[model samples]
Target: MRVFIGYVSLSGNTEKMAVNIKNRMMAVGCEVYMERLDTVEVDTLKDFDLSFIGLYTWDQEELPYEANEFYEELVQADPQGVKVALFGAGDWSQPRPCGAIDIVSNKMKSCGFAVYDRVLKIDQEAPAPDRIRQCEDFADRALSWGSKRKKWRFFIWNRMQNNPKYQRTAYLLRRALDDYPIK
Candidate 1:
């Protein structure tokens, strides 16, 4: 499996989470690519079977300045059927903790990527052992969900293709399946 991890960390907190996720996925035999979001191209997302974005919520729950361009490009890009998992580190004492995660997750969904439901949100800077474990578990769940989704889509497509009456239904069903977040 191919995986892409894009992250923006001003304080190194989210970077630690991204690294943990990348290492876990790579250990599982996945071809993992990790880069800062500023250097990542939205067009390249289609090449990966799974992707993760790590970002911290800025003041007043805004996305960091570095992520604005990527977010805009993602909004403009066509749907590519890539599955994305979101993770981040933020101060729990803030009024809107990890707000960027919600923003990015919603955008990814609106742009037609299959999003994983289990988002990793760590409190503050340093990632403890438990947070690292959460990152690994998040990676595992994403791989498992992608594997099952692939099989399910293939089976449904093949069955529906053989019957012309169900072709349109199949298309709609596939879209719904892609849009739905995997648990």
Candidate 2:
């Protein structure tokens, strides 16, 4: 599957988690595009079949400026057919841990993306083995979801045309999805 991973990290914690997720995805043989929020072209999100969004929660659970900007662009974009997954790093000791996950997840849902079931959180640093295992499980689930005929119905097929990188099987599935009904 084609996957996009975008994240913002001030302390390097979020970036670390993002990398872990990317590596795990790669290990599973999924094609992945990873970028930092400061450098990523938000419009590119529409091109991927699945996306993993990561960020760090700032003081009072607010978004860092770069993350806030990306979040706004993501909200404005037409991401209806993409499957999304969220991960974040924050002070778990705080009353609320990784609030950015909730914020970003809600925004993505508002834009009509199908969010993955799990939202990963790190207390203050990169993932340990347990956390890495969580991401692996998420990767497995995402791969399975990407392959399902029912999940493809959400994609906007016209947008997928002309992409040579799309595998033949994926292309055919998208074509089929275009004709499939929502309900």
Task: Write down the RMSD of all candidates, one decimal each.
Answer: 10.6, 7.7
lDDT of each: 0.83, 0.76
What TM-score does each of the candidates earn?
A: 0.78, 0.75
Worst 10 contiguous positions by lDDT, candidate 1: 147-156
* lDDT computed for candidate 1: 0.83
Q: Indicate the TM-score of model 1.
A: 0.78
Question: What residue pairs clash in candidate 2, if any at all?
Answer: none
Candidate 2, 1-183: lDDT as tens digits: 688998899878778778878998787556889988778766777788788888889888788888767777775777767777888888968888888789888887877878876788878844488667766777667666655565443333332443466567566775687876344
| Cα-based lDDT at residue 132, candidate 2 | 75
